[model samples]
Target: MSRKENAASLVQDYAEVFICPVCGDTVEVVELKSVVCPKRHTFDFAKQGYINISTRSMKVNYDKELFAARENIIMKHKLYDPLHTRLLEVIKVEAANNPRSLLLDAGAGEGSHLAKILDQMKTVTGIGIDISKEGIRLAASKSEKAMWLVGDLANIPVKDQSLHTIINILSPANYQEFKRVLIENGLMIKVVPGANYLIELRDTILEEQKRFFTNEETISLFKQHYSDVQIEELTYTKELHQEELRDLIKMSPLSWNAEQESINEVRNREHFGITIDLAILIGKNR
Candidate 1:
């Protein structure tokens, strides 16, 4: 089947999980082409195989090139293999008593992270939602296993208390919206950057301002929004060639504000060693 057909099939199978972005009414797949709600708010699936369910217009800085670089770094370079493994381990432990029927990857950029995690599981169905149409389109092109959609985090286009698990990785979070979609006692795994994450890149491009960072404020905020909060720290380094380093620089936000000279200097290096430090937070709904 084509990507559109496959996406339609998946949407039909899990139609009950969706809601109209405008009216908040239950949604249904219509004739395998579109989703419609009782109040007549409708969204059509794109030819690329993803649905656009966003309610309002918003500016997004991420572009197609950024997602392409990210895909190469995550899927081809395998820099995030350790992180994915840890996530899988956590998911298994946290949901030991219940079956992980459905998982929502909020702010799922290019869908690589979600795709990687779902690859190891046999029964879990994943829904990758992102505000960037470019990211969602690229994601849909790569995988038909998970449903990809262009959606806003402020108003997730999913039913209340419907998700079995929610994973947020290196993306913004809407805790209230997440709580609304997550089932009672459901699992939430959030990954935040550690103090020394990408220290090499920071030193090269960020200079003096590249001093060790902290996620204390973020951790405190998460604890306030979530219950049974637990943190797991994973730190490591990966060797990257010039091309890989270029892609990494393009994919990360740290280089966004750096001077072109600094970015060029880092990317032109023969080989670079980069640190991957992350704090994985696990929590459950009350």
Candidate 2:
């Protein structure tokens, strides 16, 4: 049976072992009990079976046009294939040792990574949450098995210490929230842009755009929240056609900062290969 069916079958199984989104504890999952911990904090799951445990909701800007461009780019090609491959490899590594259970894709913009990763795993149910309504809508339509939520990362609305694995790819991360939501021995996977990720695009946008990206910084931050951090960088070049060129700019943050003249020049140029520097960091919750 599918994971959705499986998750439904175990509705009561979670009644006792719910992962508390606050304090990272294994809290009770009973209904109308007014969830409370020794610390005197309390939360309640909504009628929809989702609990809001996040500390606060963040202000996010998400427009249909921006998400539309992102959808166009992600659907057309393998822009994030290397990152996706690494995530599956890690998930498989974990599954080889035990049964795969719950998977969380935090900041899971539109669910491509979760869909791809779970497509390779067995008996894993996925929850994908992003603050962008547009993103969650895309994710909801991305697959049947993955439950999609329009939510924030700093305050994950989950049971504390309840998740098996969470993958954060090319997006914002809240290590504290992740640490809270992950079970002991749980895995957290994060991907960030390495320097030279879009050098051509960056250079076109400005002469000194290098100040914005730092893979080293990303690693440094992960070290604070997780133990045994591992970093990997994958590089490839894809010769671009006109349509791909358009795809490249539309989804790129660099494009948002580019001058109109440079944007016009990029549109006119014919061929270029981008160096995609991505870092994959995997660690256990401490």
Candidate 3:
């Protein structure tokens, strides 16, 4: 069997804690005990330490190359690190001691952000759902500590009111599904680029389309669904080498529409630096 076929539960150790995704009831885990709701819904926690929380299929064209670009950019500390660090700090401070706090990463690509958050909190489990199977496969390969599924963000697979924190990292949001799965005071965190974000890279990729999102506009959307909306813009500059710079260009959606030859030219150019205008929004589900 290939490594893909050999994927299994990360461990057999589990606490006496479980939640019914349908009714939002708390359940206990006994040895060899599979999850069974009062309504007779049963979900067995795989030995691989994850769950299949997606109810429907979501099709997409993302392949290994896309997931690699995402992972490479993240590892280089150029684009995602600042936002990723903020997420870890927020979860540790706000939702640390809940008897049960399920972290659902809506557009989790390769499961890096969710995995980092899990490491920061002592007792937390996460479900990473992506539209691409290749993304989940890479995540599962990295650590059996988290669960990965091939699903879409618009339609989540878990029970209602079952989450403590939900992270949308440069991904799409399904606010209605989020409201259903969150407690009254549960938090939703989002990271989007500021208008001037990655201008250097955009110079080559954005052909006067102006695709940057407005922080206030996003805040308004969140306000439409969630209350106590708070928005902060983090601006920082990073130094980069040629290889790291090349990876950043390869991984972004901006590169997708660019001519392949032009992309190659940009990738081959020498060392460069880019300023990142990252906006973070955190709020409650009203």
Which of the two candidates, 2 or 3, achieves a greater TM-score against the reference? 3
Error of 3 at 92 (Å): 1.4
Models 1 onward score TM values of 0.96, 0.79, 0.80
lDDT of 1 by residue, 134-235 (tens): 899988887777899898888888888988889999888999999999989889888999988998888888868555689998889899988999999999
**lDDT of every predicted structure (CA atoms):** 0.88, 0.69, 0.68
TM-score of 1: 0.96
Per-residue lDDT tens digits for candidate 2, residues 70-106, read 7665566667676677778787776566564778899
- Candidate that would win on TM-score: 1
RMSD of each: 1.4, 4.8, 4.4
Q: Model 1 Cα displacement at 110 (Å)?
A: 0.8
Rank candidates, lDDT, best first: 1, 2, 3
User: Which residue pairs clash within candidate 2?
Assistant: 19-159, 19-160, 20-159, 20-160, 21-159, 21-160
Ranking by TM-score: 1, 3, 2
The better-scoring model by TM-score among 1 and 3 is 1
Q: In model 2, which regions exceed 4 Å deviation?
A: 1-59, 209-212
